[model samples]
Target: MFRLKTMIGLFAGALMLTAGISQASATELRIASGFGDNHSATRALREVFARKVEELTDGRYTVSVFPNSELGQATEMVNQAQSGINFGVYVSSAFYNSQVPELGVTNLPFVFPDRETAFKVFDGPFGDKFKPLFEKSGLVVLGYMELGFRNVTNSVRKIAEPADLKGLKIRLQNNPVHIATFRQLGANPVSIDGSEMFAALSQGVVDAQENPYSVINAFRLYDAGQKYMSDTGHFFDVIVFAGSKSMLDAMSAEDRQAILNAGRLATEAQRKFAKEDEAADLKSILSHGVTFTRLTPEEREDFRKATLPVYDLVRERLGAGLVDEFLADVDAAK
Candidate 1:
């Protein structure tokens, strides 16, 4: 009986040692996003991206997702990822423009005629040229996901022409190119953070704002008294999925490859979700009694023409050579 009790004690001790080793072998990567939980990008990150990473890594790696600015605002979250406080971040391309001003080339109004042309440019040589810029800022480009084309929403009136936007105070992202584009169209552009947008609209701090249908619906901007929406499609926005270079470098090659593969899959899935959700999101927004306007080709051309000097403004800010190359690339892609 004494021998048997000693053997049982030894067995239990071995089991505890094994459990500790198993726990220590697993690594948890935290990914942060400014988008709300309901946003398709957030959903893709949680469902497709996180799941694939765990599966591909054979449970050696796990992901923790914090959405809706739980980690921090978009730019702050990007800083966390850069510093390795968070393992990765999914943020707007516009947010990265401060660090890589060349990225502003992508934010130029009407640069991409449609989604297909945009994808071709980003997935090909143009993207190859820009990826290094992001890497220099301590990020490894995982993949680019679609944020979709931006549309105008307002409490004031329907926007069918450039003159219709005259004197309207529109909330815009803190991007110089975007602000310049709106200013060219005769609206007063106010830079407000995403978290404050609904309140700003509701309280009349701004009469108008621009975002994709997904954002307006997810944030319920209609409830904020925004009764007019126009399919401006001014800028084809992109969401960049990036990992910390420092943190990724610390990982084994096999582990790093697993993360990259997961990111690619997640980005593809996210783009699909964004495209699929747009029509439904628009229908939902219209159901809220928001007036909608779909600009004809001629009307869109007028807005595009009014903002033409923005291209020159971009050239002045980002250099004519780079902007010219980008335009050539965009034209070639088409």
Candidate 2:
């Protein structure tokens, strides 16, 4: 069998294209994502990937995206994808970090300077090194996209320094690394799904929660009666499009490239969604009457200084070389 790379953009393209005339073949792949309708991040990926895939594959392959967890919740989608009962899952790295400890590296506080640096590190060294860790666990990572940088919104009074974080029970995703990072930083971390977080905060089950502006704004955490907010890019959420390794291996080379291209298209759209929405999202919260406490550089450093030991945590599990490779590449990219 000739590889598609050799067939593309040549006279051989005609011969290569003739092999796929089966009407009985699988026409659609199932894709699950957790973003609520109208949310920027989820909207970008769900709509863009589906459209790009249909175009790229010339309608032979379709991706039916389940947005708003209509099929099942995002966390459960992983196991489904792994079983090949589902084709792919749109999941946050935070959720998978507990299962594949190497991913805990992403949850480390103050790791990347900002959102751009975060993605650069992930797309280059950090994500490259960590992609195989998923393969080892029977999954193939299609690609990484941004959920935007997370910030803290609390019902507590204004937060200005590390001491301000004390005793606030912030809801975190159910993962050890998320809990550990918050614990080390002095907040009482409450583990829960993002779907439940706004209500948990509203009813006093939690005093605060952390998420990207898109999420904070979309979930209407501010409307839930929160008062104070902090920009704590403590960690970056790399939305990973992943699925069964074997299923991907079973794909025809063209289908494999189509899936990969869709993931990239989704990322390009997701990044645009995040970048364009950042300013408006935060401002929208203010209009909803949530108070903002923008952290000065000194305050941010205070938080970073306290949580700096997380390097040991990441280096121990993910290898010092991994972090070094990540840091060097990100520095150059920045």
Candidate 3:
């Protein structure tokens, strides 16, 4: 009986050693985003990428996701990825304008007629042009996740024309292009972070804000006294899924391929989720008693014209005529 017990102890020790080796062999990656844990982007990363990457890499790699800006703000997360610390971040193309101003081209108002056109452009050759731009800033562009078309929400009134937005204190992301566009439309656009948006809207710190329907619903902004929503669809938001270039470069070819494949899967999942959530989100917001307005074609055109000077503003900051050339190319391709 004593000899049998000793043999069992030896077997348990060997099993423990094997488990330790297996755990140490897997490379764990950290992915962070500002979206809530239940947000589609977070779900895609956790469900689609995290679950598949290990299998895709034959158990060589795994992922951990941090949502709700737990890792840091979007800008801080981008900086972490740039430093090659095995970090991935879901940020906006508008945020990239700070690192590479020309990337702001993707954020231009009314650039794409609709989400379908925007996705085709981003998934095609046009999106390829920005890869090197991202690499130059120490990031590997994994995929472009959809944020959908941003619209306007305010407590003041329904915004049907450019004049309707005048003098309203609106909260916008800290993107210069966005600030300039809103300034042109005559609203007082204040740059603020996402985490502070709910309070800003609730406390009268800002009377208006703009974001995708999903985002507006996710943060429960409608409950914060925002009474009106207009489907301006001014800027089609693109969430950039990215990783540290150096870390990606250091990986073996097979591992890199696995990462890319996982990213593609995550992007597909996010886009699908965004599409499905939009209508549901809008419905939920309506249930909160917020009035909705679908912009008439002429009213949308008024916004388009009002913000046209933003192209020149972008040109002056990025380079002369870059915006015009980019838009022309996109139009010709379409």
The TM-score measured for candidate 3 stands at 0.93
lDDT scores for all predictions? Answer: 0.91, 0.78, 0.87
What TM-score, computed on C-alpha atoms, does each candidate reach? 0.94, 0.87, 0.93
Q: How well is each residue in 1-334 modelled by candidate 3, as lDDT tens digits?
A: 9999999999999999988898798888998888888788888999998888898888888899988888877788888889966469997777776566777877888888988888877887768888898899999888899988999999999989999999999999889888988999999999888888999999999999999988899999988889999999999988999988898888899989989999999999999988888899999999999989998999899899989999887888877766676787668656
Q: What TM-score, to 2 decimals, does candidate 1 have?
A: 0.94
Q: Give the candidate order by descending TM-score.
A: 1, 3, 2
The candidate scoring highest on lDDT is 1
- Evaluated at residue 152, the lDDT of candidate 3 is 96
Candidate 2 clashing pairs, residues 3+ apart or interchain: none
Residue 62: error of model 2 in Å? 1.5
Over 108-204, each residue of candidate 2 has an lDDT whose tens digit, in order, gives: 7776787778877777755787778788877888778778677888887878887888898989887666777788878999888766776798899
Q: Give the range where candidate 1 is weakest over 10 consecutive residues by summed lDDT.
A: 91-100
Clashing pairs in 1: none
Order of candidate numbers by lDDT, starting with the best:
1, 3, 2
